[model samples]
Target: MQTEEGMVQDMKVLVVDDEKLVRRGLISMMPWDRYGMKVIAEAMNGTKALECMAAEPADIVFTDLMMPEMSGFELMEQLKLQYPRTAVVVLSCHEEFAFAQQAIRRGAIDYVVKNDLETDVMDEVLERIAASVRSRADNRPEQQEASLHPLFYEGESPVRLHGIPGTEAQLMPHGDSAQQASAEVCQALWQGMRWLYEDESFEQLLTLTAELRLPQSQLKDMVFPVLLKSGYLLLSLEHSLRWISRLEQSRRWEEWREVLQEERSYLRNLLFREKHAAEVVQGILQAVVYMHGKEELDFSQNEVADVANMSRTYFSQSFKGVTGKVFQDYVKELRLYKARQLLLQSSKPIYSIAQQVGFKDEKYFSKMFQQQYGMLPSAYRNQNPLRVE
Candidate 1:
């Protein structure tokens, strides 16, 4: 059923067949609601289907073999490469076994003969396809859930262990033993990320965890995805770190060590369930650090907008939305915060601290600090007693 807001609880389907009568019958007769499928659009041929795909995203395609402009084979190839998320099902006559075989080989999920097109068959096909699509919905971390089905057999790496019992290894988690093993595997993944980026001691953990009886190869396979995902995460994180390097010079590397420690859980979660969100937040933090480190760079909202890869206007809005402060205000407050810390902690002159926080003149920095904190830099240092670290 479709809601008042036009949100239909149906798997979006694109039906493409050259024969008008067949296409119409399939679209009109199929119990789409029952199978949780919605015939969002119909195409007379493969060419038309491709055109529609660009405008309307479909969860699956039910296409005919013989078409005028483009054949089912061609369409299936395009769909497999381009819209991999959208599954394909070939629709040809029963005698066209060779065509159906070819379609299946080309990555069509299933094939249905035109003469043998029973409602039950279509219902079953749609149900299965809907299940596949729904499984990928962004609810939790994606990396942790590997399908138990045979389809993933080709994609998975061979399982091996250093001190395990069985020669033939299975990747599927079974009981409490398997659950504990999987947790250990996840911890290894976290360790590997730290090893690669933060230079954390990971080899010791790997050598010590051999008592888990996991196949060495299986553990390697599990660790592989985390390594690959962390590469991208590291690139985005490093991009932000570049900006931070300019903000403060004292124990700069140590500062990164501290910040990465704080954000490790967020990064690991990104490596597992929410990679893109992690990248965005990493970039944001990097921007903050960069602005602080480069206390005298004269950076502007537009520059930051460009760095964040957002439109100047949208960047401003997102900056406020995420950080709860306008971009300029956030930058100023950040700089002032750094300036205040320097004032109390270090014997660095007020002018030097002001310059270090990105202000050209000490007077400007002092005035901004006073307006923000209701006190001059010297006065703040005098009133607020520094806590010994």
Candidate 2:
């Protein structure tokens, strides 16, 4: 987004999102090179984004709303004051339309729904956004409240599943009131939620719930409660339409059970075996996913935790519980793993490889490499050199 003189760089973009996948997806959604657009940088949160912009200002920023330490709103507010020329575009979930509206009022030039993005939809959005940037129609006020239409959505609204995060649970088919769970039954059901809220496996949770043998409608109602209590509500609601389809099609209890069984591995990966209960697990989930997506896991757990809006102690504990490994250990392992891959597959120098994977000291990287593989990086490359034809 660096300007040659005073004119803005057309479509020179920076993406900010806690989730690395979403950030990468937005960047790669179109072939920027072909369109004279460049992805300036990718930042995990607004704070890092500001630093990136200060070093090399981007013409436009595509940021998400619910980040940890620095939310998109805060970032935009800063942009309005510090970098007024830089166009701000919000990337949001459908349910966050109200927040996006507020962002528009503040100073965002435009917004796009993350949940509804398709290649074609993204093309139209990018064109519109780029045009606005080129024309310098900066942060124009909306004539009316921005409303979401089906054209901007790919599936049924998540609200249909449980009406946003903190509301009362809804029954699928209206179970009999008399048959509704009693205090004791509800308490017992709540007790069963341990299989979910705690870091228990999906199979274990399903096994416990299956034993209860409640009516299908009542049982269906239990899903949201379990997810709500587990801090998996937002994650689940993000994929609600998919699960709701299964719930609707499965007439029998067994069918419903089968649907859940299919999702076991995915759900299992999402849960930690020793859950540190908090209202929001998105921070933990985002941090883990963000780390995995990177070739160089350079940042500290504290940095990631801070960006995710969790206490360092809590983030460390929750990360260990969810991933079954300490954060530093996990990062070390990932770094070494990538270094090993690069050593074997890439012709880059050993020191270069080490630095690329985030080790500033080549000797330290070599020591870790030798410790991990029983040989130094150079030795490993010699043993397993890859020749590209």
Task: Specify the highest-TM-score model's number.
Answer: 1
lDDT value, residue 75 of candidate 2: 90
What TM-score goes with each of the models? Answer: 0.36, 0.35
Residue pairs that clash (backbone atoms under 3 angstroms), model 2: 199-272, 199-273
Q: Summarize candidate 2's per-residue lDDT along 1-389 as a digit string, tens digits.
A: 33557665546688999999888787877666655578979999989999999998888898987676787888998988888778888877532323433554565656566877877666666666665566453322232124221221222123221123553323223344432433235536443533333334445454444433354444545663343323222222323333433444444455666766665335554563555453345566667556645766567777788766889998788777775667777778767766866765678887888888889999999999788656787765663313111
TM-score of model 1 (CA atoms): 0.36
Q: Give the range of the ten consecutive residues with the poorest summed lDDT in model 2.
A: 148-157
Query: Candidate 1 residues 79-148, lDDT tens each?
Result: 8778876777777643232343355356555556566567766675455545544543422234433433
Native-vs-model 2 lDDT? Answer: 0.61
Error of 1 at 124 (Å): 3.5
Residue 368, candidate 2: Cα error in Å is 49
